[model samples]
Target: MASSDLVRRIVLLVVLCVSGGAMAQTGQDTSLVERGRYLATAADCVACHTTDPAKPFAGGVSIPTPFGQIVAPNITPDPDTGIGKWTDEEFYRAMHEGVGRNGENLYPAFPYDAFTKLSREDVLAIKAYLFSLPAMSQDNPVSELGFPFNQRWILSGWKLLNLRKGEMKPEPAQDDAWNRGAYLVEALAHCGTCHTPRDFSMGSDESRKFGGGAVGSWQAYNITPDPVSGIGDWSDDELVEYMRTGMVAGKGGAAGGMGEAVEHSLSKLPEQDLRDIVTYLRAQKPVRDPADEKPRHGWGAPSEDVSAFRGDETGDDPDGRAIFYGACSSCHGMAGAGTDDGEFPPLFRNTVVGARQANNLVMAILEGVHRTVDGETVSMEAFEHKLTSAEVAAVSNYVLKTYGNPAGATVDAAMVDELRRNAGEQPLVAKLAMPGLIIGVIVILALVFWLLTRRRRRSLR
Candidate 1:
């Protein structure tokens, strides 16, 4: 080993030796909060939990699902409004069994299924780290769920079917790097919570693991080793670069939840850890989708049509070409070629534009792009307020045909309007919740009336 590595190890050993007894007694080391902080970042806890950076982890951020919006609760150490009173065991149960402090069934929205894979030591460490933060009292917003969704009892059934609690076991045959990567990917990172397709009950489908799933307003594309449908076409370097930098030009760029993960979690990870992740991903079974005849990022070409721009005064009707020229052509060239350095990516072959669906492309227009890492930031301005729904659809369609996959031209003004309203595909539970609630209510009312009538009749007799 290098001299620097030896020195670092020695220093760590000395510190542990001095503090080990206290650590064992308290089951926490304040000095160890740094480790907890790193793990929390790996879990990307702040992304969902913190709405305001000033009051970190005083959660009220709305996490939108097809069923409804779940407001993340405050995790800061405030006794009244947060988890300050929770024992380490209580916190562990919440993580390991999806049960809250008061023994309430917590929502799957907290992603406890993945957390269940975390070891008790790690869970406590995360808690210790959270507790180490400044306690801030912030009342959690009640979840805005419809009908039966607002009921928590159903989560018990959901858990029985889907929850698998266990620490990640190392594959004996694999190297240490691969094992570490597996734990990081499965437990801390919980990539499957977003990247894997969901079953009928809205739990992840392990059969089609890493086959591609959807986050709100964006599709999490396949990352398995399938050439056409997944990242098999990408080099190891490309994958690592994308994880660290959030964009590997001419291939894919992160946006939405993926962007958040990259910016907050993946980008901060050590290079070796990123490589290990790539290594583990490389070993996964390649899942191919018949729909992908070509790569999602493989389609598209620079536009050659200059004739459409010759007209001077635009009419009342929304013109996509005119809109794109007015707004987009400055950063991305008239020919759709970005900068030589790819600071502004070329439209052609962008993963967002050439996706199987146009949802992400539309979202990108509305949300824009801003990912910062390594002291550099890549940005795009959001046009949601600036552009009308019709104009957004028009421009999206125009980009699709001229510079991206023509099949992605499915966006219309109505679809854009709907996306603005609610930005996710309806899950099975969401589809059933309304009818289920109505039937349940009717049954309860009938039972109550029958009981009341019988009691009155008996009393009269």
Candidate 2:
């Protein structure tokens, strides 16, 4: 062979080797990115971060707390507006310490308290997946809060009391499945964030873990193994079905935050993960509330005369019967039997309607249900713009009386108006009774500090 041809062959070999190495590196990166994507899904990051489906991760979600409305910031990789400029360490700190890139304390609304239990490897993986996304330039609205609540510095004090900053360790005594379930429920899913009642500091009430709590207009019902207030009566199959479809016939269906969760997170989870969650939930200590002696679906007798109650549509003020017939009867029959195919659920034996509190039923009428399951979209058009508050109250009361819990029959127009106004807002303990206490404590601390400084100055003089 000629010397020139031999040299060219060597060059070709070197180029091939370099190309192969680059391909191997690319494959490894892709695997990590995919793993990150799965972890993010498990965490349900998109539920809070993405408000607009068209602009996923370009956050503009308004999260209401006792302090005020804190908007979720963009998590996309946009250099100017999103986390694109964030280093891996910064992202990890935000997850593990609830601190921002600028060293400012983040509000607990981010759920970093639970996220702190995540392994450093998992946290970094989530960051890696987020960084792999296309950059989106979306500016989030500034949080609008009242007085001392607006002060982010207050979170530092709050964190000192509530933040359990550490990664979760697997229980050695438990089987691998149980351990996995425990981690998913406690760390990744953070179900207690909604289900557990809050203390004065707005931390999850560990004593009442999964013992039902209110989330804005919706109720995050008990998931413990209690037969009365919780899911003790539910079979593993029933629990799995509910998690996957957000509904189980003769039981109840999910709406509001729970519905959003089913639609965006739980429904898409792997079947084994769903089973694991169920297993963990079933093992929880039953914390029964007397008020929930029976499941929501078990309350409320069906109205016998619903079919005969058509009203005068031509009248100036149509009665609930007329409104029901005109607007809701087509999907939910005159007898509230719902569609036979189960696409439109029966109002009778429905958990939302049968619940002791009428808030969910009222909100459903006003906001309507919109969820997707198994590639099919389920929607109920919102009536907020269409019906007057009084009209909504009337219709809701009618449904409650005719097909649901009679206790809910007392809902009035004023109640509907209140629910409408505070639609998606979260209840803050500080707003409830802590504000005055917090102020008083601050005042006492300030006075004590002032006296100490004065004494020190006098001694120096």
Best model number under lDDT: 1
**1-461 per-residue lDDT for model 1 (tens digits):** 99999999999999998788766866547646877888999999999999998999999999878888999999999999999999989999999999998889999989899999998888888988999999998998799987677889989889988999877788999999899889888889998898899988998899999989988767888889888888898999999999999999888678888988998899999999899998889889999988767888888888855655763355765778877887898999988888888888889988878777898889889889888887888899999899999999989998998888888787888899877854488987778878887899999999999999999999999
> How many backbone clashes does every candidate have?
0, 0
lDDT of 2 by residue, 1-461 (tens): 99999999999999999999999999988988898898898888898899888889999898766566888999999999999989989998999899999999998889898899999988888888999999989888998977777888988888998999999999999888888898899889988888888776778889999887767667788899987678888889989999899889888778888888888889989999999998888888899887665777776554445543556556665377667877888888767888888888888888888777888888888888888988878788789999998888778877888888877777777888878765344446555546677789999999999999999999999
Clashing pairs in 1: none
Worst lDDT window (10 residues) for model 1? 304-313
In model 1, the Cα lDDT at residue 202 comes to 90
RMSD of each: 7.1, 4.0
Candidate lDDT (C-alpha), each: 0.87, 0.84
lDDT of 2 at 238: 89
Where is model 2 poorest over a 10-residue stretch in terms of lDDT?
A: 301-310
